[model samples]
Target: MTQLFSDMFGTIIDNTPYMKAIGAYYAGASEDGITMAMPWREDLVGDPETRVIASGVVTALLDNCCGMAVWDRINAFKAVATLDLRIDYMRPALPGHELKVTAKCYKLTRSIGFVRAFAYETSVDDPVAAAQGAFIVTALKSDATGVKS
Candidate 1:
């Protein structure tokens, strides 16, 4: 990975509280790729009857993975806002299975990044969900002021 992307990854892993709260750990990353792990907990499950994971949790995992892809390309601490995200749920995820999300940034420009991500239970060949999205990249700003310049 480039120095910029490496630096950005470090900044995120070290400073993002939400990422930490969700137990998002960096599995591995390269210049054009990233993998993140999120353990399934009962608290995050949505369907009690089916014992399946919630769609929101799946979305969050994809979002984080996609963001990491962008971060990996930029290689810097930047404020990112999801412009659009599309997720396709292919299969139900069991309660006890941990989800692994792998994302890649194939295209990045001055202010936008495009990424694709997949959530796999144990094998990449069998993905639970697939996602494609774009994110608006901006300079880092304090949370107190939601504005990004």
Candidate 2:
């Protein structure tokens, strides 16, 4: 198994169909942060003219990256729900370019995890979007089987 899958929470995320379909992969984690990548897909493109990725997809990427950062720090297979996510889109991503997101969990309390993430196409210095969010972490329940859980 990949290092990402070796962790319980990441294993569950890897098996999720939607995440797989979007080509979101765990690049790795470090003391600095957790990184993930979403490979450009034709299906995810919103404007064929610009070949820019959809805003919704970008939001999802940010949300997942934040959640993963929290999970990596917590080192547990817990269910997390996004309390709020705010993204600032700086520019559009070019077609065929991969979107890389690096998320850092700067603060983690008993129930809430605070994260900040940036998405870039080719250069981290020139990010396409930046995000900050919070998530509510809870114990994984047997009844929660879907990816949303």
Candidate 3:
């Protein structure tokens, strides 16, 4: 588990394009969940005057965070499809403030996983967005070498 965490938060994380594009980074990880951060970018601005980050970006951030939490909880990489994701914007994120999102896989069954997540700029209690989602879990197939794909 320790090695998995190191690999995930280390080299493997750096090579992911979407994560890189959004400036996502490992903020923290625990037995139940993982937290990721996305720094605010001028190019991602939703309103010119307010400079608040776009709601779409927040949705993406939470979605990715939730999915990662599921993988971490399962302790293995598995193919999962987002079945449903519902995000509610509580408030607009402050301009230039980095958004931190925490997500957890609360329940896992034979075919699905339930996840919940929240996003905030300064503190978790004061969330800017909250989300609840379900993912369809699938078994990953290995190649001839017998390594999980």
Q: Highest TM-score, which number?
A: 3
Better of 1 and 3 by lDDT: 3
Scanning candidate 1 in windows of ten residues, the lowest lDDT window is 140-149
lDDT of 3 by residue, 25-87 (tens): 878786547888889999888888899998988988888788777777677777766888999
Look at candidate 2 and give me any clashing residue pairs.
none
Q: What is the C-alpha lDDT of each candidate?
A: 0.78, 0.80, 0.79
Checking candidate 1 for backbone clashes, the offending pairs are: 4-75, 5-75
Candidate 2: misplaced stretches above 4 Å? 1-10, 141-149
Compared with the true structure, the alpha-carbon lDDT of candidate 2 equals 0.80
Which one wins on lDDT?
2
Residue-wise C-alpha lDDT for candidate 1, range 1-149, written one tens digit per residue: 42455544645664667667666677787543788888888777799998787888888878888887887777666877788889999999868888888899889999899999989988778999999998888777545222221
**TM-score for each candidate, following the candidate numbering:** 0.82, 0.85, 0.87
